[model samples]
Target: MKRTLVWLGGMATVTALLVASTGAANAISRGNMPAYCRGEVSAMYATKPMYVKTGKIVKARDGSLSIQGTVDKGSEGIKAFACRFDKKGNFIDVMAMTSDGE
Candidate 1:
């Protein structure tokens, strides 16, 4: 009876760990992209007090990812940008999105 109780306790611990790990993975997968992009975009723009408003993550046919958004640099006006990343979520580049949709 004691051995059986030990086995059950071990299984319960393993189950709890698995559940916790799954939650953490989900959080990482759905990370705060807007906040993450904000820092990088602000640095690129070289502006203080910048704001980034980003939309959902988009997956391209080439397996890359992009976050489309706008940056507001108070007096400098707002500009559209696309933050590009690899399939593994590694940042590639941030580029201005022109009015002509370039």
Candidate 2:
């Protein structure tokens, strides 16, 4: 009976340790997800034809993202664009944008 109790206690401790470790790893991954998402989007932007200057990349804790930047249009000066991404870092769409009327 004592041996059985010890075995159960050891198993419980191992399970708790595993759970804690997994949780910490998940938090770290989630913490870095926004930066990763921004880098991914920036790489995609670099593939476009126009000259680009990245502005702000916002990644929500829920996995939503918004990226804003300016694209040079040669004779047309610069135009701002805002892009949206889903939680999985998938591109959704882009729209004309400006910084609070500036």
Candidate 3:
């Protein structure tokens, strides 16, 4: 009985540590977004429906990244898309919604 309790306690401790580490990693990831992209994101989400849910830096074919997120636009529900930016801080390649349907 005592041995079982000790094993359970150890497992709980390990689980807690893993959860804490994952939270920290997510916090770091949340801010790793490029500065220019943040500003553009702000502007993009300034209007109705469009909102920046989360941003992640992903590896592309060249192992370099842009940014991607799941955005919600009013009753349109949630949609995922990649972000585009130029050296001049221009936002391009915004393929959020389709004119045919949601």
Per-model C-alpha lDDT, please? 0.74, 0.61, 0.54
Per-prediction TM-score to the true structure, in the order listed: 0.59, 0.44, 0.39
Candidate 2 residue-wise lDDT, 1-102, digit = tens:
999999999999999999888672222244444454445444554534335655566888887877677666556566677766676655566666644344
Over 1-102, each residue of candidate 1 has an lDDT whose tens digit, in order, gives 999999999999999999988672321143765666666787877764247778888889987788888877667678888887777766768888845334
Q: Top TM-score: which candidate number?
A: 1
Top model number, lDDT: 1
Model 1: worst 10 consecutive residues (lDDT sum): 24-33
lDDT of 3: 0.54
Candidate 1 residue runs with Cα over 4 Å from true position = 1-30, 48-50, 99-102
What CA root-mean-square deviation does each model show from the true structure?
9.9, 12.1, 12.8
* Ranking of all candidate structures by their lDDT, best first: 1, 2, 3
- lDDT (Cα, 0-100) at 61 in candidate 1: 95
Task: Give lDDT for model 2.
Answer: 0.61
* Candidate 2 weakest ten by summed lDDT: 24-33
lDDT of 1 at 86: 73
User: Which residue pairs in model 2 clash with each other?
Assistant: none
